[model samples]
Target: MTHTTHTTRTTGHVAAPRPDVYRALLDPAAIPRWRVPAGMSCRVHTFEPHEGGAFRVSLTYDDPASTSGKSTARTDTYHGRFTRLVPDGEVVEEMEFETEDPAFQGLMTITTTLTDAPGGGTDVSVLHTGLPEAVAPADNETGMRMALDNLARLLEHPG
Candidate 1:
């Protein structure tokens, strides 16, 4: 049988320096605050920020019946490692879902790049490749966008 995979990309501009944005992306504590999409909550099971370090996280739908989850009825759990981290420029991770379904089996790669914007702040671009067939491209893009929005909000204002 031939294997197939999909890809999704999302971009956003945050009113913060590249260093700040890069820090937030690597901080385990900050992940749950901004990496989750609307209608979902995140939990960091394990995290090690260094390159080659492992991490595990789970995203659960606020409403269990909202959609089918890969790990459970309401949660999508995944574990991966930091493949590469270039200080204030980029981050690369390789992950796979914790599931039994054949449709959700694959090694996915997430590449996040940060660059300076014309006026100010940082331009963040995220590319997700090797997505499983069951994961809709539109939904994945939307989720990534929402997460970027959340990150922007978190950095633009501090209370």
Candidate 2:
């Protein structure tokens, strides 16, 4: 199996938001609020949020083609667990994504680091490893940025 690695960084000013990275990533109820692109929704079918705990997220898009005219549908399913969690700073999750599209099938491990910035903001960095060499790194970079941007927006509007 060919291996590839990609890294992405996203920084935003979050005013007095929670400083805990585990809280931001592991909370099932808060996942749909920020774990995907804007307009897409995430549902955590099972989440334990600790080392060796089970984690699964069903991502549903709002497009007709994605949902096949259904009101809600799953576009992608992620099954994995938190390999490591460092309280409010770092989390390492090993995940495998299953999709209807064959091109997207792969095992990936994402190491997320959240650092307290100068102005009470969080500098979020994600290092993704074990991607298939056939997959373009740019695609991973763009997707990570979009997800982080969505997360920033969600933190801004908690309702």
Runs in model 2 deviating more than 4 A are 1-13, 17-21, 66-74, 99-103
Candidate 1, position 125, lDDT? 97
Per-residue error at 31 for model 1, in Å?
0.6
Question: TM-score of the candidate numbered 1?
Answer: 0.97
- Winning candidate number (lDDT): 1
Off by over 4 Å in 1: none
* TM-scores for every candidate against the unseen true structure: 0.97, 0.78
RMSD of every candidate to native, in Å, equals 0.9, 3.9
Report the C-alpha lDDT of model 1 over 26-62, residue by residue, as the tens digit: 9999999999999999999999999999999999999
- lDDT of all predictions, in order shown? 0.95, 0.69
Lowest lDDT sum, 10 consecutive residues, model 1, at 64-73
Q: Compute the lDDT of residue 36 as modeled in candidate 2.
A: 77
